[model samples]
Target: MSAREPSYFAKCACGKFCAELYGEPFLMGGANCYCNDCVAACYYCDDKARKEGKTNISMRCADYQGAGAAISCWLLDNLRITSGKDQLRGFKMSAKSPLCRTYTACCCTPMIYIGQKFAPRWRAFNLNCVTRASDGQPLKPTEMSNVMGDFALKEAWDQIPAGQPKYKMIPWGLFPKVLAVIFLPFLFPGSTVKVLEEDRAVPGMFIDAAMVTEVVSAETYVAAGVRVPKALLEDKKGK
Candidate 1:
């Protein structure tokens, strides 16, 4: 069954993929993925927690929901970075593909997944963090129906969506900007990414991993979730 419970904390609602409903600036489409990649990316890839030795962690990745669907949006513009600005971290399935997914390193909150596996700069945010824009309404992700991955094949991926990449349906119009992300310097100005290279030699293959280095804002970490200490908040306020 698809997880249809909406998040009360999600302030932004990514636009649906219906062409008729959304005209120009198609924005981004949402999906419920249950592929192995999405599952592992949500669980493991916790270098921060591993290094910090923080066990008993609870994360909110897309798959945790029954449907396993996440919202697809452009992190560059769509994401407003309300809070937890400094706690954001990222990881990929492997070094070859740069489909990086993000989570809050502080609280282990799996928030978004971004990649260029099929399309350019695919920003798949955790739909659990997605809420209706008006009236702060909540959305039942499972009730919304699964788009990318299916519930029948939970662990197996044979029944996945058959589109361009044989896994997802990419909006061709968004290709221009998606492909252009590769041209931009690894450490572009204003990018919150920290590039980390893989040790294994891939010869001419892309083995670079873009990890988050620091979080600028220290006032608060997460909204409606983790919070910073009053002393820390006061210190930031003093500064």
Candidate 2:
């Protein structure tokens, strides 16, 4: 991607946070991910809104009453938090979880998720956080339904329209795609991948991983006066 390539803007509902996503959704593609963890992340953010007395604030993501689906895309070396970076914070479903999803503290909008596999090389942006594509084009369409079907979120699972392809989990092909992207900067030195300088500080980037909070169980939300989503409660029962 060139420096002048069309970029996408992802802003939190309160207009307090924004991220510029350079380049397009690469090899990993986009999807409506209905995994339990994703749903919980939405509910957690919604609860944050309610607790902050910003009940009217939109979290910009959801699936149904109790379960949620995140319209997300995986990109390599393409994200830059342009504003309200100081207000961005990360949380994990559990201490052992390898993923950390970020929320805009000002409005509780979950903006991005970073997985442990490749660190800062790649990040997943919640498309719900993106309200505009600067290329004067429509945002990328979701290419698949992931972690859906006969598993997870009984109530919301039935709500998904039939006929489209659904996967119980991400396909194995994704691993290789991610690996390829991780190595792309080496193969093509002219690629648009940005590398952070040692002394530079970029909030919302994975560098703050040490400060991420761990939400161990439903009680963790209760203690904070936030209701745990029913989908998460069901997951606990099944486990």
User: By TM-score, who's the top model here?
Assistant: 2
Q: Candidate 2, residues 1-239: lDDT per residue as tens digits?
A: 64644377777778788777776665444566665566666667777777887632333234355344555564545666667878777787765455667777787777776553344466666666665464544365556544544345666666666885566666666767766677766777787456467313333454444555545477654542334557557768887
Query: What TM-score goes with each of the models?
Result: 0.44, 0.72
Global Cα lDDT for candidate 2 = 0.60
User: Which segments of candidate 1 are over 4 A away from where they belong?
Assistant: 1-29, 45-69, 115-122, 139-239
Clash count in backbone of candidate 2: 0
Q: Can you write out model 1's per-residue Cα lDDT over 1-239, one digit (the tens) per residue?
A: 97323223332122211011111111344444544455444444333455566531223233322223345444333233444434545554443334545566554545656543432323455555454543454344432224344222343334334542323434455456655664453446655333224312211112224442222233112221122334445655676
TM value for model 2: 0.72
After TM-score superposition, the amount by which residue 189's alpha carbon in candidate 2 deviates from its true location, in angstroms, is 13
